[model samples]
Target: MDKKKVSSWLESELKGYTLKSSQDDFVNFLIKQADKIDKEDHLLLKDLAIDWINSEQKDLTTWGMTIAVEYNIQEATPSIEKLLGKVKEGKLWTLYYLWYIDGFLKRIKEKKE
Candidate 1:
């Protein structure tokens, strides 16, 4: 691999993405970034999946779950299911917010898809 070119390209294309001054620093940074991203991806996917399971007015939650699961977001299912139980117990505004965000996200997904 053209490490220098890849490094330069990454630095140019991604904000805050830069090769460290030292090789050890760069290796450590990459490891730390990968770990951080894994954690963040877990959390975001969890929220999105919960938003799906808690949804009402349509099977939007199911659709959301389908999408998340397709992308291997397993961590989200439990949270989503928990929130769904709460929403089903008559937490009105929670359902509304879920639906609203679902609509917004659906539009975004449609455009991307």
Candidate 2:
């Protein structure tokens, strides 16, 4: 698939979008659709993913992590780590976020190999 086309579609799809499904369901839809696109679109998707992850909404942040993991956006590690640090101690949400970041880092390593 064309990177430009995919990026444009993502931009429009995510605009003013609200979470209406479970996090996993939403993430699955995004990753499955993104998988149809070429890996060369990583830069565009990475930007979108990072932006989403940085959003104030918890759902958006989760979606962002999913996109980052799916696309192997290693460049997002530092930001992910920073967010992890801010998670309140002993919160269950930290574990969930950690799982995503760990998977994302693993994919990055695999890509490097």
Candidate 3:
């Protein structure tokens, strides 16, 4: 995966902003691009998702959590938990993100059992 290319497309297509109407569309589009994901992509996504989660911007944070959730990046769970405690916005959508992540992970565990 070309990090630069993906970065460019993300910035250009979404303008680094998550509009309410297009939010689900972008997330769904990314989920459909399973062919593009690999080990390197996973690592890149983990890093980027964590960075976005750490950011103060709500939209960036949403994108971060969305990617984490869609890609099954449980690595970001700790950061999301931390954000929930460290930031004011954490009480909002952050709560749902954490819930979704925790639920998703639990389901994965259940399926494996």
Candidate 4:
């Protein structure tokens, strides 16, 4: 994570990736990024998640939910149910995004303990 501008590149990718962009390219890339993040990176992802959860685009919303689940981002808590409803109403495959919503709340509850 220390390749100077490399983080920006990652941020750019995360920010700009679209569902049509290589078909699941963002999800595929996030699979690698999911565990490598530290506090600063988590914070960055949190900020991104805020907007992503609010996004109308299912791909962005799902990716935001993925980051929220992986990182336990509390800030995203408020939007979880609402975002789930939106994604569920979208294309069927986007329903795959709903998978992580289960763990997200469970982990948040655990964190409170």
Compare the candidates by TM-score and give the number of the best one. Answer: 3
Off by over 4 Å in 3: 1-9, 16-23, 30-40, 88-113
Expressed as tens digits, the lDDT of each residue in 1-113 for candidate 1 is 23344334333332364665785665455445334434545554445444545654344454444445445555554545454455556664456656644444454445445
Q: TM per model?
A: 0.29, 0.56, 0.58, 0.51
lDDT of 4 by residue, 1-113 (tens): 44335445555666665664673676667756654554447665577766776765665666766777666687787787666666678843367767766566566556656
**lDDT of all predictions:** 0.47, 0.63, 0.60, 0.64
lDDT string for model 3 (1-65, tens) is 66656655654554544553775776765554432544447776677767777774676666666
Candidate 2 wrongly placed segments (more than 4 Å): 1-25, 36-40, 89-113
Residue pairs of candidate 1 with colliding backbone atoms: 50-80, 52-61
- Lowest summed lDDT window (length 10), candidate 4: 1-10
Find the 10 residues in a row with the least total lDDT in model 2.
85-94
- Answer with 3 or 4, whichever has the higher lDDT: 4
> How many clashes does each candidate structure show, in the order listed?
2, 0, 0, 0
Range of the 10 consecutive residues with the lowest summed lDDT in candidate 1: 6-15
lDDT of 2: 0.63
Could you give the candidate ranking by lDDT, starting with the highest? Answer: 4, 2, 3, 1
**Displacement of the residue 2 alpha carbon in candidate 4, Å:** 16
Query: Model 3, 56: alpha-carbon shift in Å?
Result: 1.9
